[model samples]
Structure formats: C-alpha cells, structure tokens
Target: MTARPPLWRDLRVIRAAAQVAALVAVGLLLYVLWFNLTNNLRRLGITTGFDFLDLPSGVNVADNPISPGAPLRRTLLVGIKNTFALVVVGIPLLTVIGVLVGVARLSTNWLVAKAAAIYVETLRNIPPLLVIFFVFFAVILQLPPPRTPLVFGGLVVSNLRITVPWVETGPGADLYGWALVGGLLVAGGVAWWRTRVYERTGRPHHRVLWAISILGVVAVAGWFLLDGPIRPSLPVVDGQRVSGGFSGLGAYYAMLSALVLYTASHVAEIVRGSILAVPKGQTEAALALALSPFQRLRHVILPQAMRIAIPPIISQYLNYTKNTSLGIAVGYAEITLIVFQAIGNGRPAPQSILLLMGAYLVFSLTISALVNYLNRRLRYVTN
Candidate 1:
C-alpha cells in the first residue's frame, strides 16, 4: 500500500521489530541469570551437573527395595514409583468420596446435607499440612501397635504398618495380563457398539452390564486357560512384622488419607456447584417426563455437571499430587523426600532440586494432559 508505506515506517514493520527486541531482551535476561547462578555455584564449590545421578545414593528408601549401593537414578525411580502409587490409589477413592459427599450435600435429608456441609467446610478450611499431621499423629499413629495388629481376614492394620491381600504373580502372569487387557479392549468395543445401537434404535442398551460380563468371562477364562497365573496373597503378621501380601508404611496411609480427605472436600464443593449450575429448566423437563430422581440425575443432570466439574477436578488432582511432597514431614519416600535426602547426604543440591522439579513437572503435565483430553471428549459439541 503506497510502496508499503516505506517498510521502516510501516506499523507492521515497527510491531515486528518491537517483538524481536522484546524477545532478545528476555533471552539476555535469562542468560544473565543462568551465568550468575553458575558463577555463584562455582565459587561455592558445588557441582551443578547431573553426573551425580550415576553415583550410589548411599541410602535405603523405606517401603522400597533400593539398596544403598544403587545409583541415584534408581533411587529417584523408586521415589517416583512411590509418588505414583499414592496418586493412582488416592484419585479414584477421592472421586468416589467426593461424588458421594457432593450428592449428599444436596440430599433431601437435612442431616445428610448438614453433615456433608460440615465435612466440606471443616476439611477444606484446614491446611493440608495440618491434615497430614492430624492423620499421621492423631489417627494412624493412634492405631494399635504391630505386635497386636487389627486383623480382618486378609487385611492387617497397625500404627507401624498396614497390609492387605494382593495378587501374586506367577509364571505366565504377563501373558495372562496381556490377554485380560485384550479382553478389556473387546469389552470397550462392545460398549461402543451398544452405545451406537441405543442411539439408533432408542433401546435400553445396558452397555455397562454387557461390558462387565464380557470382561469377567474373558478374565475368568483366561485365568483357567493360563493355569491360574495369578493368585491372591493374604497378609500374614509375624510378631511386629508383616509378610505375604502388600504392605503399606504408616507414612503412606497418613499421606494418602490426608490428601484424599482434603482434596475430596474441594472436589465435593466443585461437584456440588457444578450440579447446581445446571439449568433448572432441564430438571423441570426431566420431571415432566416422569423420570425418577436417580434417573433424572443419571440421564439428565450428571452428564452435564461432570463436563463442568472435570476441569476444576483436574486442578485439585494436581494439587494433591504436589502436596504429596509433604510426605517428607511424615517420612514417606516420595520424590521430594528422596531429593532432600540426597542433598543432605552431600549430593549436589542444585542438580537434585532441578531433577526434583522436573519430576513433579512431568507428573503435573501428564495429569493435565490426560484430564484435558477427557474434558475435550466430554465437551458439548456446538454446531
């Protein structure tokens, strides 16, 4: 336009030049910060590299089999595993409890509604660290000692540890496991097929029952076909020590319980608010159709509420995962605890901290990515 308004004086050219200048300034600032950090570390005689990852950790993690002679890399892996263990179990339990409490908060029964309100108010108001301490000292530590543990079939509980029945892998277990996974895939396909049929014919699909039955049959058949490659192992207590099934450290339970209760309180509130946000017209329409309360909720309300709830729940999940670092206070060997342990043992503090941050960053990003994917799938498609 008019010789591009002389390129140097053009608004577009000036904007581009400004952006380049800003980017260069930001890059220079970052470089300067890095240079200062390196110089300071060098003067302090602290190694800033990751070569220490290959060296022996010289410390054994509780509830893990990592030897003191194992490399720091292995130690960190164990820590990551422990953190994952907390998250994997905590998330589902929290979801179940949160949903129950959330629905209860809206119950017709005054007692139930009040009780849920009290729980949500109390727990959410408390600091998560305080919850962790309360769980550790006032609850878990208050259990009977290991010498006289609570015993209920395959489960054992004590202040020292808790143990539960778990599957014991035997020969061909891997193959059988893979077969079960294939069964799940088949079941999912069956569910999708049922969904399509229901959409087309307006029939009762009972997709859940069909999927579960398919999965169960395949799993049972695979178990027999593989000659029982997995069996249940019950916990056995032997005078202050437990063996046979899976054993959880007291710290694990404390961290898990505290985080679940605290995070679930937030999740409960989110869920309750989401449910309330659903348009009243939708509920009235469902009622006009003579739908029972449960049917109304299951078919008309929950689906929409969940779409709203999931994004916030994803944030709560990340919060719980990060709060797990507080396990250090109770002696759980999560990644943060492990990093601090290494640092105290003369490892390079900066590198260990950098790795620790990276570990958590990876965890958060992964959880966010997965939940965001689900959110996208659940989102309403507007034409």
Candidate 2:
C-alpha cells in the first residue's frame, strides 16, 4: 500500500485550498461593493469619477483661511489637516495623562486609588458625545464672553478666544526658522552626548538638562543676533474680540480637552489591568533588593506592564482620533464634520463618506503600525 503523503505536504495543500477559498470570498465581496456603488451612483445620475474634487467647494470652514471658492479637493485637504491637528495634539496629551492616572490607580493610598477608580468608572461608562457637551458647557461656555476678557500677566482668555503672546513673524523670519532648526539639532546632539556619558560612567544621564541648556543657549543667541526681530504679538483687550497673539477657539479647546479626558479614563483602566497582570514575583524581587517603591515601579513594574499596555493604548488612541469627528456638535470642523456638512449641502454623500472613512483608516493604521513596531521591539522573544 502506498504510504499516505507526509503531513507537511498535506498541510501545504490544505493551506493552499483555504487561501484560494478566502480569495474567492474576498473577490465576491469586492464585486458586490463595486456593483452597489456604481448602481446607486448611476441611479442618482451622479458622475462617479474623482472630478468633483476639482470643482469649487461652496462651503466655509471656521477659522480656516480656505474660502468657499477653493476646490473641493483643497477643502478635503483642509479637513484632513484639521483631523491631523487633533490627532497629533490629543495623542501625546492623553498618553501622558493616561499613564499618570493608570499608575495612580495602583497607589498605596486608598483614597488616591479609589478616586482614580471612580474617575475611570464614571467617564468610561458615559458616551463621549455627552462628555464633549459637558466640557463645552462646564469649562468653555463658562469663560467670560469676548467683551470682558480675563487677563493673566499678558495672556487673555475668553469664550471667543485664548490668546497668548507669541513670536510675531517679521523680516528675518527665515533666519529665526533656521535658528530654531539649529537649536533642535544642537539639543539632539547634546542628548546623544549625555547618553554616551551615561553608558560609560553609569551616572544618571541628565539628557534633559543637556538638551534644554543647548536649546536655551541657541534661542538666546538667536534673539539678540536677529536684533529682536521676533517680538511678542500680545493680545490687546479690544472690545469683544481680542486682536493679535495666537488664540485657540473655545470650541477647539473644549473638544480637545473632553476627548482627551474621556479617552484617558479608558487608558487608565487598561494600565491598571496590565499592572495587575504582571508577575507578583517581579515586584517581590525588586523589594528584596531594597529598591524604593517609585524606583521599583518605574524600572521594573512599568517596563513590563508597558509591553502589555501598549496594544490597548493604541486602540484608545484610534478611538480618540475617530471621536474627533463628533466635534461637529461642538463646531470643531474636523474631517467628519466637514464631510457631513458637505454632504448636507448636496455633495455626493457616498464618496464624501468614503473619503472620510479613508482618512480615519489612514490615521488608525499609521498609529497601529507605529505601536506594533515599538511593541515588537519591547516584547521578549521566547523559543
């Protein structure tokens, strides 16, 4: 009797068959999606090419310089830029706050831990939209209307704007930009030197000190060398609306703060769970070595817990990014809001929605890819 084919050979055949089946299924699904899109587009007498992108978009965005006469493609690009601004700003702020709250939940003090738990439980259970609304009403709306601005030092804060004295652009702005770039490079080099010192001497590398000092030195030198070309654009207490200085609108800050807080609560829970999941022996060993609690946590517990925490943290980031779309209710003008407004104004809903989805998909996937790369680097490989 002929011996049965080797299991490895059979397995290959089985895998090949499964792959073919999957491909067919995927092809069928894509065909259905394409057919539906084309059929509906045709039924509605809509042209299906991306040519609509070239036509002038007849809508205006708040705070953006984009005029209604701008091409639809340009409007979409502005929407994308707005979405990116939120993601870039929100992710770092939320991550820092989340990690702090997560660690706080594990605090030895009963009150601290309980308070953290309450915060997480309360915020995580509520809808993000409500949180946005609450933030708008409670914090932003309470700000003095633009007429009577609250002045602190030189900064002016009010409902219509939050203006801080900023480096005013003038001639030699190009020189200032170059100086800033040089300062950053110097700071990076100093940080690298500090790392080398730490590696050789096992001393606490004050990379932060080195970087800050280099940056400060360069900045001061640049200021004088340029004859004070960069003057402060102080906000004046003009009637109602303040002029000059960079100001973040009340709605923008409200949306950003609410989403950050709402998402941080979920991140806190993930961190707490990950910390608990760490092997108890690891903590005990650190204690046996007489490591201080904070040092033990920073060096041992957190490093390990982070490996577990990162994946979930990426999810929270993605959620926060997507939730920025809900900023429409608060007039944030993120991609989703802009797209919805466009659709409401009689643009092709399906294509606009598709573009919106694509924007989010890119954001989510890019974040996931970065996290996954870091996760791989941090993960312990076992045979």
Clashes of each: 0, 0
Predicted candidate 1 versus true structure: per-residue lDDT over 1-383, tens digit per residue? 44568878899999999999999999999999999999999999998888999999999888777899999999999999999999999999999999989989999999999999999999999999999999999999999988899999889999888999998999999999898899899999999999999999999999999999999999999999899999999988887788889988999999999999999999999999999999999999999999999999999999989998998999999999999999999999999999999999999887788899999999999999999998998898999
Clashing pairs in 1: none
Instruction: Identify the candidate with maximal lDDT.
Output: 1
Give the top-scoring candidate (TM-score). Answer: 1
- For 126-236, candidate 2 gives per-residue lDDT tens digits of 999999999999989999988788999889999777888876877887898899898999899889988999999999999998899888888888888887768888888
Candidate 1 to native Cα RMSD, angstroms: 2.2
Off by over 4 Å in 2: 1-15, 194-208, 380-383
Model 1 off-target regions past 4 Å? 1-10, 189-207
Return model 2's CA RMSD, one decimal. Answer: 3.1
